[model samples]
Target: MTKEENLEKMRHSTSHVMAEAVQSLFTGVRFGIGPAIEDGFYYDFELARPLTPEDLPAIENKIREIVDADYPFIREEVDKEEARQLFADQPYKLELIDEFPDNRVTIYKQGSFADLCRGPHVASTSEIKAFKLTHIAGAYWRGDERSPMLQRIYGVAFDSEAELEGYLARQAEAMKRDHRKLGKELDIFSIHEEIGPGLVCWHPRGALIRQIIEDFWKAEHIKRGYDIVYTPHIAKLALWKTSGHWDFYRDYLYSPIEVEGQEYILRPMNCLGHILIYNSQLRSYRDLPLRYAELGTVYRYERTGVLHGMARVRGFTQDDAHIFCRPDQIEAEVAGVLKLAQLMMSTFGFNDYELLLSTRPERYVGSIQMWDEATDSLATVLEKLELPYDLDPGEGVFYGPKIDIKLRDALGHAWQGPTIQVDFNLPERFDVCYIGDDGAEHPVVMIHRTVLGSMERFVACLTEHYGGVFPVWLSPLQVVIIPIADRHVDYAQQIKNELEEEAIRSRVDERAERMSWKIREAQLQKIPYMLIVGDKEVESSNVSLRLRSGEDVGMRSLLQVKSLIKAVIEARAQTALEGESI
Candidate 1:
């Protein structure tokens, strides 16, 4: 078997052993589904009482004992009636069985525990060589809020000890770089119970960073021949129905509102609005490929359990754009979007990423000929660009085929970055057309794309990627001036004024705190530069500079420092000084 398949088998079998150990310790505990996740596995249990951290070691010890026994995993195929009798006490299992339409069922048994599962586990418990129980959390059965909450025990298994150790080390680093923890410490953003879950309130610092990102996005789009536009956050519900979103995407949409006896909905996507703008006037073939861009805010209903800090939220602004082009212009427009996406990602220090081509799905719209043509166009772009991509068959959106870009961060973790899709369904449904050379009206092809995905999630990814030590170009507070004593406060203000005149985001720390304390605070805030003003520096008309890395650069003239910062900002450098000493 392949290495990945083997690892999955080992992890799944370890979870079975873990369940056996739990049943041995806690009698009469009902089981829930346990499946292998990205790097680990988790099993849910309905125990009589809540499990604590103290209980983990005992469970781990029991699991080790079971592993030592070298129990073989036996699989059996039974009829529905037999399976029902075997798991009569497990209401969850019975519910799962009832949902299946077939009479045949599969079960896996190891030691004294058995579960109704369709699994390809390892041959025996001894194959689970390296394993560790990580932590516990409360998960609702079947992920539904109305169901009973269960205790989830998470664990990871690997083929070798070294691999497990490396994974553990990365996990430790990830904890330190957790965006939620850093967000609170840096006072960037917050979510309160009163304000509702999945809704973020950006503090001053976070808002400033967002503004900078938005400004950069708009400027780049304008430079690339895109017309920036604004659209309302709500529109008539009939619009969604005509666009087919109400039929396919209604689950994520909020409840409708009655305005003047007509139903309106909070916008869940910006594509429909862009299409409406294209349909506002008749167009000729010369006016084809009109690119419309918007940093539009959208709302979607997400379950509370799945809501994360800013990575997953109910409301967010999408760096969205759509192009309405003729059939012959489809390939060029898609290639142009690919280039723009690459530029944006590389600017953010993401040099390594993966691209995927998703083909037509089972429930796709438009004719077979149209779907084939659109899919061929997307594939041709990837081929012509010589970009390597994976083919995900039957995974495209209902309306079109798409190219998905995933960016890898410093920790070797991947996150969704950009998406480019060629759509024929929307134009057909909305009756968007342009006059062809033959003096006949033909349907316009729509291409929807986004470079940053969403503002909130992108910022969250950036926070963890850089560990909150943003480069000078993107740092909300680029520089902080620290005064040695009350006597030097005037000099520090003068330095701040000079930096501000150059359009640098600088701050003067005029607090009644010691110079060392102020410097430490600035360092903790992860500012790019700290300018120290003292009696000696003021006498010489210079300021001592210290980088966030604690590298001390000797005193330099005020203009020299300003010149250094401006150069970095103008170049949009991704690092503070590029390891240069002033």
Candidate 2:
């Protein structure tokens, strides 16, 4: 067999080995479809007993034992009736058999297990090695949530041990940077079961950071000629119908609420609202490139089981905007949006990003020429910016072609952000228009773009990216004044007041604990500076700086300390808070 055929057979055979091993270990574990994914394969099963983390090792051992026995994977093609009889006890396999052609069906037999499958498996089970079952989760049969919840045993098969180890190590590192753990540790945000899932309640510390980010975002948008706008959280259902969101995208949207018999749907997107604002006025050639921005909060329907901490949520605020530009300005507007996304993300210490440009999908509504033009425009912008990107064929939304940017965190996990999408359907449906210099009304080209994705998800990503070690500018408490003794309380308060007057977020820790304990608490809170003011500092009119890392930076004036912090904050510098870089 050719190398391509051999690799396919290898992965296919590994699935059988995994299934055989599971069946041997658990007497009544019914099988489901097991297919090879991009990096690995997974099998679904309906277990008589729910398997926990403890059951993994034994199942793995059984799989290895099966491989060691070197069972030959014999393939046979039989008529549909024979296949059905062979898999009589397995309903899921029998379902496949019923769907198969009446002419013939293939089955693979290994050891005591014979499964109804389409063959091209490896010759023997001994060829299966360098594989692992990475995770176990509950999945709905055939991805329909109403169907039976089956046990999904996810595993990875690699060509070598080194590759397997590398994948495992990356997963371990991702766990270390898991945002839920870091969010609590850093006191960023939380979702209480009592308050319900998919909703975030930001604590004071977290809200302060978000405000800082929003302030920066607003200032940048202003500088880039974007008009800030606000709209109602709930809009008339008639508006959604006009935008076509009610028809095509309503499944992912929240149900409408009736107020006095008028259906009002919670806005799932800011695009339609912004389009309404654009259509509120007749546009001329001079107003061809109007940009509107808003930190718009939106609601979408996400099932309870799929809701994650911050990353996936039912209600979230998006850093959303819409660009109403002429067809001739499409390329420049796309490039401008791309530049803005990079600038904002990089300030938050996200420098590496992967760009994906998705072209028209099979069921797209726009004409082929329009799709080609929009895609070519985006490609031109990418090329002009000298950015490397991948083309995702037939992945664009039904409305238009688009660009997606995925940012890499410190742990090397990619999070989706900064999407730019061209929309022909919305403008056509809304009948948005702009008049040219020649006095002819034309269809406006609307581009929907988002930077930082959503506030909740962005905060989660930032928490994990920095590992909770936020920069001085983003840190909730930039400075904490820790008095060595009760006698120094006056001096600490004085310094705190001075720092506060300078707009520095400084606080005085007045707890009756010992000096060492106060310092430790400040460090634990990840405060950037622990200003230790005591007799020496009072006498010298200077404060001894206990850097967050516990290093004594000798003595510096209160002014000098403020200057150091201001420099770091202004630069938005990212460094180990405890180390030489600070």
Candidate 3:
């Protein structure tokens, strides 16, 4: 076999070894399915007792024993009736056998165990060299919630010990960068059990950071000739029906509530609201390219097992906007939005992104010509920008084609953040129009775009990217004043007041704790700068500025410090403005 084919066979064989190990440890543990994933493999089992971390070692040891035995994996073809009878005790396996209309079926056997799987396993168990079970979780049988629950053991295996060691080290490093832990450690945000899952409660510090981000977004949108707007969170169900969301997306949305005789729903998107705003007024070609921006909050129904911190949540706020333009202007508008998305992402220190342009799906709503036009607009923009992107056939939304941008995180993990989509269905449904150059009414083209796709996911990405050490301009507490002694309190308070007056967030550590303890607290909070006020510095009417790293920059005048911070903020703003133009 070729090297690549051998690796696939080895991965498949490892699954059998894991299954044998599970059967040895847990008697009467019925198996579901074992399959290879991107990096490794996993097996699901319906065990009598819940499996924990302590059970992994015993199971792994059994797998090692099986490997030492060097059991040969033999494949054989069997008739459908014979296969069904052989796997009668295993209902799930029997069901698999029943699904095959053909009489012939492939089965693999090792030692005393046999599985009804298509055979492409390694020659023997000894070839499975390095492996480790990663985690334990509950998975529904066949991914159906109404089905039986199974205990899933997720693990990764490699051909060599060196590869396994490297994988483990990378996993450890990623755990350190997990955003949920960092968010709590930095006191940025929290999700209380009492408040329910998939919902976030932004604390005081986190709220401040969110506000700063929103303000910057508003400023940039205004400069780009985009109008900011807001709408109600709950709307009549008839509005969604008119927009087709009630039919296509009702399952992912919360159940409606009755208000008098009308049913209302908490919106899962802001598109309908923006469409209403457009329908509110008649327009001409002169009013084309009308861009509306909103940091609109939305709620969606998420399965319980899928919720993971801020990345996957039921409630989130999107930095969303919709642009209404003429068909001829679609290319320029799409290019502009792409430039805007790149700017917003790069401003947050994301330089590398994976771009995907998805085409029409099988069940798409628009005409072939409309789909072709929408796809061409995005493609043309990418060509003009000289950007390398992947084209995915039959992967777009039912309404239109889209461009998805996934930002690479610190650990080389990709997070989907930005997206730009074209829509033809909404215009037709809403009957929106504009006066063309010929003075004839024509349907307008609409583009939906979001830079930070969802605020909750964006914050999670930022938390992991910075490792809780946010940049100066984005830091919740930009500076903290730590007075070394009671005598320095007056000067420290005065400096803090001045900074506050200048709209630079500053706080005085007026606690009875020692200066060292106070500084440590500030560091723990990840404050960007710590200003120390001692008697000598107070006498000189200057403050000693200490960075988060503990390096002191002597002493500088109050105005000088203010000017320095102002310059830093201005530089960031300039870079941000440049990034938006891209």
Candidate 4:
């Protein structure tokens, strides 16, 4: 067996042991599905009371006992009726058993515990070498909102203690770098329960950072010949039906609202609007490759259980664009998007990333020939650029095939960043066309893309990637002036004003706090620069410059400091914060 298969089997076996432990601990615990995930394993159970962190230790102890016993895992295949009899007391199991179409069913047993599962477990309970019960979460029985909610215990298992410890260390770092924690600490963004979950409210600092990013994004798109456009949030439901979204993507869409007898719903994507704009007028071949871009907000019905901080939200603004071009322009357009995605990633300090070429799904709308051509175009571009990518078969959007850019952050966690898709179906559905050289209207090839994916998620990524210490250009508050005493407050304010004039963001901390305390607070906020003004510096007409990285550049003239900061911001340099660089 391959190493991956062995690891999966071991983890699966560890989950079974955990289930056995839970069964022993609780009076009557009814289990839902338990499966091995990418990094670990999780088991869902319906218990009398919710499980807590304090209960994990007891469960772990029970698991240790089972492991020490070294009971062999025995596999049993029996008729459906026999399986029902075996798990008559477990309602969830009975429900699953009823769903099985065949009479033969697989069950595994170790010692006194048994579960309805297919075999592939370790030889014995003792094979689980290293494991840890990480945390607990609430999960629906089958991800249905109206279904019964169950408690899910998550854990990680490895072949060695060293591997387990390494994973735990990374988990700890991930907790520290979690965007939710850092966002709150840095006063950037927050989601309030009163405002409803998954909706972000950006504070001044966060809004400023978004403004900077959007400004930079607009400039880049203009340079690449993309026309910025705006579209409404809600559109007539029939429009989506025409675009094939209502039928294929209904699960993610919200129900339509009647406005004066007309049904309208929140737009789940920005592509259809762009397509409509393309069909708005007759176009010649000279206007081929018309790229329309929008930082448009769309709403989707993401289940509450899957709602995460910025990562999976109900509403987000996609840095979305659509290109209408002739068939021959597909390669060049795809290549341009790749280049833009690469530039965006590199500018944000993402040096490691993977590409994925996704093909058509079974329920896709386009013809087979069109699907193959679209998939081939994306593959050809990746190969022409000599870019390595994995094939994600049947993972493409219903409209077309795509190339996905998954960027790796500082902790080597991959985040979805960019996507370039070739679409031939949407233009057909909307009858988007341009006049050809033969003086006949022909179907236009459509390309959909996003360089940064979404502003909310990208900012979340930026916060975690930088550990909240954003580079000079991206930092919302580029500098803070800390006055030593009341006498120096005026000098600090003057410095802030001067920096602001240079288009550098700065604030004067005139609060009634000690200078050292203020500096520490500024450092905590991750401001790029902290300028200290004191009686000595008031005499000398200069200030002490300190970087958020904890490096101190000795007293320097305000002119010198402003010049360095302006130059850094102008160039959008990522590594100038460590005093030595200056």
Candidate 5:
């Protein structure tokens, strides 16, 4: 077998050993499916009680014993009746057996522990090595909420111990770069039980960063011929019903609010509002490709288990836009949006990304012909742009086929960055039409897109990508003035006033602390530059510069320093003092 194939079998076999250990330790522990997933393995069980981290070491010890025994994994085929009797006590396994229509069933046995499974495991328990159980979490059986919640044990196994060590080291770095930890330490954003889970309250620093992003997004959209628009957060429920969101996305929709005997709901999307605007006026082919953009906030009822910091939130603003164009203009409109997406993503220092062309799903609203045409248009744009992409079958939404781009950061983490979808269903459903030169009404093609996705998720990606050391343009406090002593306070304040007039975010460290302490505090805050003012520097009309990385940049005139900082900010450079030794 190839190396990857062997590793897969080893991981699978390790999961069986884990199951055997669990069965011996816990009496009446019903088992669920255990599968080798990407980078690791997981097994679900309805145990007598909750499993904890403290329980993992004991399980690992039992697994070691099983491995030391060198038990061969034996595959056996049995009659359906025999399989039923074998797993009669294990209802989860029996449920699997009942789903198969065949007369025979296959089972894999390692030592005395037999499980109903299809065979593709290592030869024996001894073949498994370099395995460690990581952590535990609750999972619903088959991912159905109505089903019983099961305790899931997760573990990692590699072909060698060295590989395992490397993976764990990378995981440690990932933990250090975790957005939730940095968000708290930097006072970026916070979630409270009173405000509910999956909802974020942006602090001053985070909001300032968000404002900078918003300003850039709006400016770019306007430059691309998009007219900014706004829509209410809550609308009458009947509107969603007409847009097909009520029938299709009801699960993610919140409960209705009754205002004066009318049912209203928090909008889960901004498409319907844009559609309403398109229908408000009589359009013409001459107005083809009318682009409307909005930084609209919407709400979704996300499960509590899935919420993490700003990455996944209940209320977030999407940098959403819709294009109403004729069928002939589809390619040009898509190309324009894709170009804009590329610019926005690259400006944020994301150069590594993957594109996916997602085709129609099983349950869809548009006719197959329209779906084919829309898919072809997106593919044609990709070809024209000389961009390669992978095909994801049956993953598109019920309304359209989309191009999804995932951005990879320096840490090799992928973030959902940009997307463009061609929708024919909404236009047809809403009867959104434009009068053509033939003097007749025809359905206008609708394009939905977001270059940077939601504000919350984008900020989370930025936080992790740079490890909270944001670029000069995106930094909340660009420069901090640190006065050496009480005598330098006035001069420092004057410098701060000058920088503020230059539109550079600056602050004065007025605390009665040592200059070193103040400079250390600024560095801890990840401020881009620390300007030190003392008697000598004040007398010379200069400031000592210190980088957050703790480099002394020597003393320089405030005029020259401000010019360098302003140039970096204006160019949206990825790093401050680009090409400088510091």
Candidate 6:
């Protein structure tokens, strides 16, 4: 078996053993679904009482004891009636059996436990070499809020001790770099119960960083022949119906709002608005490939339990753009978008990334011919650019085929960054057309793309990727001036003024705190540079610079420092002034 398959088997089997251990310890326990997750496995249980961490050790011991017995996993296929009779005492299992359409059912029995499951388990419990029970939580059955909440036990397993150790080390580092903790510590953003869950309120510093990012994004799009546009946050619900969003994507959409007796929707996507703009006027072939860009804010209904800090929020601003082009222009437009995505990701210091081409899913719009044509266009562009990519079958959106780019961060964890989708269904649904060379109206192909995905999630990723130590170009406050005493406050202000005149974002720490304390605070804030204007530096008309890394560069003239900072900003360097060439 492949390594991934083996790992899945090990994890699944470990979860079975854990369930058996839980049943052995707790009386009147009922089993729920248990499956292997990304790096681990979790099983849900309905017990008479809640579990505590103190109970984990005892349960772990029971699991080890069962593993020592090395009982073989025996699979049995029985009729639906027989399965239901066997699991009559287990209500959850009976419910699952009732849902099955066929008469045949599969069950696996090992040691003193039996579960209704599809079997691909390891040969025996002894195959689980290394395992650790991580934590416990309460999860709703089938992820539905109305269902009963079951106690969930999470654990991790690996084929070897060395693999387990490596995974644990990475987990520790990930905890230290957790974005939610860093976001609060750095005062970047916050979510309050009063404001409703999954809604972010960006603080002053966070807003400043977002403004800088948006400014850079707009400038780049303008330079690349995209016209910036703005659209409202709500529109008539009929517009969504026409775009096929209401029918296919209603789960993520909020309830309709009534205005003047008509139903309106909070915009869940920006593509429909961009398409409306294109349809505003009749177009010729010459006007084809019109690219419209917007940093549009959208709202979606996400379950509260799944809502994370900023990474998974209910409301966010998408760096969204759409292109309406003729059939022949499709390939070139896709190629151009690929180049733009590469440029944007590399600028953020994400050099290692993977591209995936997702094809049509089972429930999709448009004809098979159109789907094949659109899929071929995307494939042709990837080949033209000589970019390596993997095909994700049956993973595309209902409306189109897409190319998804996932960027690997410093911790080697991948985050979704960019996407390019060729949509034929929307054009057909809206009857979007342009005049062809033959003096006939023909449907125009549409492409939806995003570079940064969303501002909130991107900032979250950036915060964790750099551990809140942003580079000079992206830092909300580029420099902080520290005055040694009250006498030197005037000199510090003078330096701040000079830096501000050069359009640099600088702050003067004129608080009553000591100079050392101020320096430490600035360092903790992760400002790129701390400029100290003591008497000695004031006499020589210079400022002593200290980097966030604690590197001291002594006594540089104001002009020299300003020039260095400006050079770095202009080049969009990802590092500060360490004498490295831009």
Best by lDDT: 5
Q: Candidate 1: TM-score? A: 0.86
lDDT of 5 by residue, 1-582 (tens): 898888888888888899999999999989999989777799999988889899999999999999999999999999889998999899999899989989798999998799988869988999988989999999999999999899999999998899999999988887777778889988999999998888899999999999999999999999989999998899999988988899998989999999999999999999888889989999989988899999999999988777768988899999999999999999999999999998988898777779999999999987899999999999999999999999999989899999999865435667677889988789988999999999999999999999998999889988888888899999999999999999899999999999999999999998899999998888888899999999989999999998887888999999999998999999988878887432
Model 3, 364: alpha-carbon shift in Å? 2.9
Q: Which ten residues in a row have the lowest lDDT in candidate 5?
A: 407-416
User: What lDDT is obtained when candidate 5 is compared to the true structure?
Assistant: 0.90
**What does candidate 3's lDDT look like per residue over 517-575, in tens digits?**
99899888877678899888888998888777666667888898888777666565422
RMSD of each: 4.1, 4.2, 4.3, 4.0, 2.9, 4.1
Write down the TM-score of every candidate.
0.86, 0.85, 0.86, 0.86, 0.91, 0.85
Per-residue lDDT for 507-568 in model 1, tens only? 98999999889989998899999999898898999999898888998899999899999999
lDDT of each: 0.89, 0.86, 0.85, 0.88, 0.90, 0.89
Error of 5 at 362 (Å): 2.8
**Local accuracy of candidate 6 as per-residue lDDT tens digits, 1-582:** 899998998899889999999989989999998898777799999999999988999998999999999999999999999998999899889989999988999999999999999968988999988888889999999899799999999998888889899999988887767778878888889999998999999999889889988998999999989999999999999999888789877999999999899999999999888888899999999998899999999999987777777888999999999999998998999999899889888887767779999999999888899889989889999998999999999999888999999865445667677899888788898889999999999999899999888998888887877778777888889999998888998998988888888899999999989988998999888889889988899899999988888888888998989998898888888888756321
What TM-score, to 2 decimals, does candidate 3 have? 0.86
Q: Write the per-residue lDDT of candidate 4 for residues 298-417, one digit (tens) a residue.
A: 999988877878877989999999999999999999999998998999988877778999998887777899889878888999999998999999999887899999865545567788
Best by TM-score: 5
State how far residue 147 of model 5 sits from its true place (Å): 3.7
Name the better of 2 and 5 by TM-score: 5
Model 3 has an lDDT value of: 0.85
> Model 2, 169: alpha-carbon shift in Å?
7.1
- Between candidates 3 and 6, the one scoring higher on TM-score is 3
